[model samples]
Target: MSRYGPRPFFPGLAAALLAASVTAAPAVVTDPTAVTVALAAPVAAGMAPNCATPPALARSVSAVPWPQQRYAPERLHPLATGAGVTVAVVDSGVDRRHPQLAGRVLGGTDLLDPGGDGTRDCVGHGTGVASIIAAVPHDGSGLRGLAPAARILPVRVSEQQVVDGQGTGRTVAPDDFARAIRWAVDNNADVVNLSVVLYADHTAVRDAVGYALARDVVVVAAVGNLHGNGDPRPYPAAYEGVLGVGAIGADGVRADFSQVGSYVDLVAPGSDVLMAAPGQGHHRAEGTSYATPFVAATAALLREYHPELSAEEVAGRLKSTADPAPGNGYGAGVLNPYRAITETTGGAVARSAPVIALADDRPDPALVAQQNRRADARQRAVLLATVGGVVVVGIVLVALVVPRGARRRWRPADPN
Candidate 1:
């Protein structure tokens, strides 16, 4: 297995990665060339051993033998899917044609028109991040995304680390990022995933992040992959409104290259994370870029169950409910979608919302008729399916509908 480390956001910070695990005590990667892996320990009340299977051959927990990847599935898979929440993936666009993602991508814009696509990925980083949240995977390949039912809005940007044919490393300006944030919020995206980082004290970036916060849109960012040097906070991740995510290797310790400190919010599986590449098939990549999506996807899942919690509150819950306590670089704790989505505390907060807030407003007969027509269609479908001894869980499988003209790169995730 070839492991290419993500480029550093700062100078002199080399990326040294191995799968870290918490199933046991912390283990460090001595050989950078070796493909290190830390298999998820059998779900129990103990630690994960450092001697588990490697990522090169590790199947998703869903494919592993009974109880291997199984946890409380009932509690983990919520009846309420991420139907209403939309996630804007401001990265290298997405494969709209992927089965798992087909029909799920909402409208998106291309920032790097010269070398980008709303559906193409050059380095495969954006696709990997998108899959972590929405990829249903080609069956039996053993890749299960954290939020398998969430919808994504693929926002394209250049590879900050990669150069073009002319050999130019593009700079992701603060204004570009701010525009993406507002676009996500304006377009009904409940969450925004920023998988890249910049180390600048730009006021424009702050205002953009603050804009999302004011709108109650949850924003999650990659903490950054570059340790050893003093941890200078990475952009958006270091920004106050965003939840900065870190990476945990197989030993369950923070990766040598993962940045840390107060800016960190949570951690996730960052080493050799498997997902759809920019085009097709599966590939593995390393860095906090991948970890941030897990947090973003988990937030969507949490919203499906806790709809009223503001994005900030959701971030708080994620940090509060994370597993294995955070460390020098891993923030509040490791990311655990299974726990955060189903974990419930305190009496449920209920807001009193009236069906109609205006008494003098007159109803539009045409609009009412359209709504009635859709309602009738749904009712008939339910009745026919039930009476004929058949039923469909179509609406339950997703919270959002896959409309036409989604990302042009759509691909069905279901191999079947």
Candidate 2:
């Protein structure tokens, strides 16, 4: 009945718990050269395969998701709606036919199949990710994207989450996964959202991430969902320039499944978060994958409003403007799109001042030290001058007062 033949369902694997609903979890792309990252849960028997059938269509939702409500797109859009920016979703294919995604998706590359555009979503992960970034509001539905005006460039690299069993759809090798990142960059993507996670680091993937960063592209990725299973270091999240993201629930605490590590650069709403389904509805999903888009969308907004800012500068702004971290494992803190968009670099409050040029938060230490030395010199000069003036005044007073006291015949001077 299924494409992968009737394989015994492995209930012990971590994927089995989330098998019913498709999540933004990373799909392991098997290759001889690439290191294989096993699922977070221990495999009792053989590795667990993808679902027997594609995910069912999610029911339409009218209630505004908690992330959306918390970010309050109404307030953010007035400032910047992520206009004139393109965010590449490097994950499973994105279903561009969704009502909310209409006119927002571009004809992107599909590494899996070269003939077709990257609009077909068999796994439904990319669509939800795209929705969080740029899906437009429609028909009074409360569900809308953080950057509705931004365009999505989908790069379909994997079709299913299966690691051992290759299903009907082909999964690209790790090299091709590297190629996908290059493709997204070549296509002029301003921001790239990587909901996919890999436990083991690979040279090809690491190099590709460096390529994107070299080109000034903002790279946002999930830290991985393996806190229980040793929380192996995940990449491209752990890559030097990549913005490693962790997930937090509505309660503003790190999700139990979200990996805790030094790589986590920021946290966003990930638990019980709502996302746009493939066909025509929404699904309640949670993962570092889901949380990745919120930061990606915020990056989109930042790029839209401040086009001159380099990718690293934009990332700095996002981190600097975030709310206070609840505790460890929560990177800069929860993703605050409003603050990310409205605040200046180094956490300075934005005002009605005319826009001049972008500020560099990381001033050169040498230059700073030099300025400090100059300031100290000026302060010392001013202090010396003041002391000299005080000494002169004291001498003048002594000269005048002594004479006045003698003239007063050793009596107290009278007030005149």
Query: Which number leads on TM-score?
Result: 2
Q: Please, what is the TM-score per model? A: 0.65, 0.71
Query: Which tens-of-lDDT digit does each residue in 103-194 have in candidate 1?
Result: 66766776756443356544444566787787664565566666667788877664432212111233344567667777676667778998
Candidate 1 error regions (>4 Å): 1-75, 114-117, 160-171, 346-416
User: Which ranges of candidate 2 are over 4 A from the true structure?
Assistant: 1-54, 161-169, 347-416
Score residue 386 of candidate 1 by CA lDDT.
Answer: 88
Q: What global local distance difference test value does model 2 have?
A: 0.70
Ten residues in sequence with the least summed lDDT for candidate 2: 1-10
